[model samples]
Target: MQIAKVRGTVVSTHKEASLRGAKLLLLQYIDEEGRLLPKYEVAADQVGAGVEEWVLVTRGSAARQVEGNQTRPLDALVVAIIDTVSIDNRVLYSKKDQDRK
Candidate 1:
């Protein structure tokens, strides 16, 4: 699993049958310090994460392990919505803080 930030939503008029009802989100990789990386991925949303929320991402074959994603053609999946991220006893990012802004 990797840490990523949900950037946006993806909408497709035509797609595979297995992915018909799945929600897709655009994510940007972020380091533990909360800095965004150049890398980005479109992932199926398994946890209903919203835009700008920090999320846990599962990639490759592991993404397929998420419930309801087993037979879908998904390479990445958003598995969790993070409320806070802490490193070395310091809070790096907090949803509560962001909500105040």
Candidate 2:
């Protein structure tokens, strides 16, 4: 799994039948220090994360392993909406702090 920022939503009117009702988000990968990377991807949203929120994402085959996503065609999936991220007792990102920005 990796941390990423929800940049925006992806709307596809001609996608596969199984992905019709699924919510897809555009994510920009973030490093451990909470800096954004140049890489970007679209992920299935099971956690209802909003734009600008930090989320935990799983990619590749593991993305399809999440419950209802087993039969869907997904290369990535948002597994959790991040509330706080810390390392070495130092807070790197906090939902409350972000909201105040």
Give all TM-scores, in the order shown: 0.91, 0.92
After superposition, which runs of candidate 1 have C-alpha atoms over 4 Å from their true positions? none
- lDDT per residue for candidate 1 within 1-101, as digits (tens), equals 99999999889988888889988899999988879999999999988899889999998998899677788888998889998888898888999999899
- Flag clash pairs in model 2: none
Give the true-structure RMSD of model 2: 1.1
The candidate that achieves the highest TM-score relative to the unseen native structure: 2
lDDT of 2 by residue, 1-101 (tens): 89999999889899899897899999999998778999999999988999999999998998898778889989999999999998999898999999999
